[model samples]
Target: MELHNVDLNLLVVFDHLLRLRTVSGAAKALGLSQPAVSNALARLRRIFDDDLFVRSAKGMLPTPLAQELAEPVSYALEALQNALNRKVSFDPRHSDRDFRLAMTDIGEIHFIPRLMGTLRELAPGVSVATVRNTAVNLAEEMSQGKVDLAVGHLPELTSEFFQRRLFRQRYVCMFRPGHALDKRTIRLRDFLEADHVVVTAAGTGHARADEILARQGVQRRIRLRVPHFAALADIVASTDLIATVTHKFAERSAKYFGLRYVKHPVDLPEIQINLFWHSRYHRDPANQWLRTQVFDLFSE
Candidate 1:
């Protein structure tokens, strides 16, 4: 019962014995010799004053005392293992880590394919999960480590977070290729006269496109309002509606969607896309590796 009398190795031996139920099995599990496992068990018996496991024809069966200590010992050992891994260096080539990212729908379209390709080549064992930045309590989720990283133009992730700029992109007006306004330069009159499909992507900086135009006293004939950028291409491709979106997204999606994009007439400022992480994970080896991969892959 003395605080400093117990050997930590004995607990390791005891835990393996309870699970494997044999001295030889415990020794193999712990990479120790059978005699070493037996010696540790003997010390454990002296410390606890009980025969922890009894030999039998079937296998080594645990005594009631061993059964009582089994759950707590396993939990303690697992907790210690997690603590060590948190401070240890991360090896992406061999790590089977699952990381969660916060992004908009446009981000999923523009970032996932390239990101996944890079990960498949560099860290085959690592996996990814994505959550929309509009999720409830997103800030709190990142703070408590539920979310690993947030990528895009997220002005909300300001304080208590560290961010690195990946790139800056301007908004461009996109429409079907053969539409009436297919000229190289779009006039302000033509832009305002055309029916528009506005993306009200709340909780994202993309929404600023409409705000910037409105402040400049430029208003387009609103034909549709969608919540995400996913359907914008298909809708604009099949109709005469114009959609203003980030240049990177427009450039990537134009070919597949069969749409054409031109510079905005209202002079919208470029939005800087950033990679953000909670301050708590700023020094984590795994997080640092992930951040570096993203920056190298996309930063301009």
Candidate 2:
């Protein structure tokens, strides 16, 4: 493909189609007519010599070739947009950008409230959305722009991504204030013998706590398994079951639930929550500004 012969406008249409995944959806996203968008896609198919996307019951499904082109095209288009929209300084107070983040339930409960408070005061028009974090294929997700930033203890971050350590948190044992265990200092034997509620987001197969217990050849009988940290705190507050959770989350919810936190009996490694983003956005001014806000808010 010769640069002189290729129409740059086609790339814009391709990007819209890639994101919206349907001719009509692409038209809506790009403010073009459906027939016009379909014509552009036809031209793109001829230039690339591939169907690019296939019609499906759900929507237009990208072929392998189109999937391969999606990221580079989106990145290129974003860079062009930034260059064209360049100003001497960025004023978050006036900009209405939406930032999408991937975070665990713990992060949503503990960190987002403070972050949103800052945003509400500074950038009232800005929006924030959170998606659940997954341990599998995180790098690919970040690279594809499906998630703008990933905030959590991301043990699976790739070398290609940039990471900033936000804060370190350790595990703490939580129970209602009047529970029997609250009367005495928690010991390893007592912890092992007590009925517990384990918080498992994905499912109850294996977890960090389980690994720690296996290493010590001591296992606590899990009386129940709950999905969210907030729910676990709620259950622990009203029942005899004990919950081991991140100290930050436990402390944040302690007063609300009338619960008391004690040091976990077994030695557990501190979980370091970090902020991660793809290298492609490392130099983006808007992304940089948002990352700075996150770092400052969490660090403080």
Top lDDT prediction, candidate number = 1
Superposing all C-alpha atoms, what RMSD in Å does each candidate have to the true structure?
9.0, 15.4
TM-score: model 2 vs. ground truth: 0.69
Clashing pairs in 2: none
Query: For this target, which candidate reaches the highest TM-score against the unseen true structure?
Result: 1
Task: Give the residue spans of candidate 2 off by over 4 A.
Answer: 4-89, 135-137, 202-206
lDDT by residue (1-300, candidate 2, tens digit) is 786787988999998888888898888888899999999999999999999999999799899999999999899889999999987556799989888888877778877889999999989989998887764466787788767888887677777789898888788888888887895578887888889998776521125765676788878888898766657777887889998887877787676777888888878888777889999888877778888999998863
TM of each candidate vs. truth: 0.71, 0.69
lDDT of 1 by residue, 1-300 (tens): 874888888888888888888889988888999999888989889999999899999778999999999999899989988998875689989999999999998999988899999999989999999999887588899999999999988888888999999999988888898998887888989988999998898767787777778888886799899988778888998988888888988887677876888888878899999999999999999999999988998899
| Clash list (residue pairs), candidate 1 | none
Q: What's the lDDT for residue 249 in model 2? A: 71
- Candidate 1's TM-score reads 0.71
* Overall lDDT per candidate, in order of appearance: 0.88, 0.82
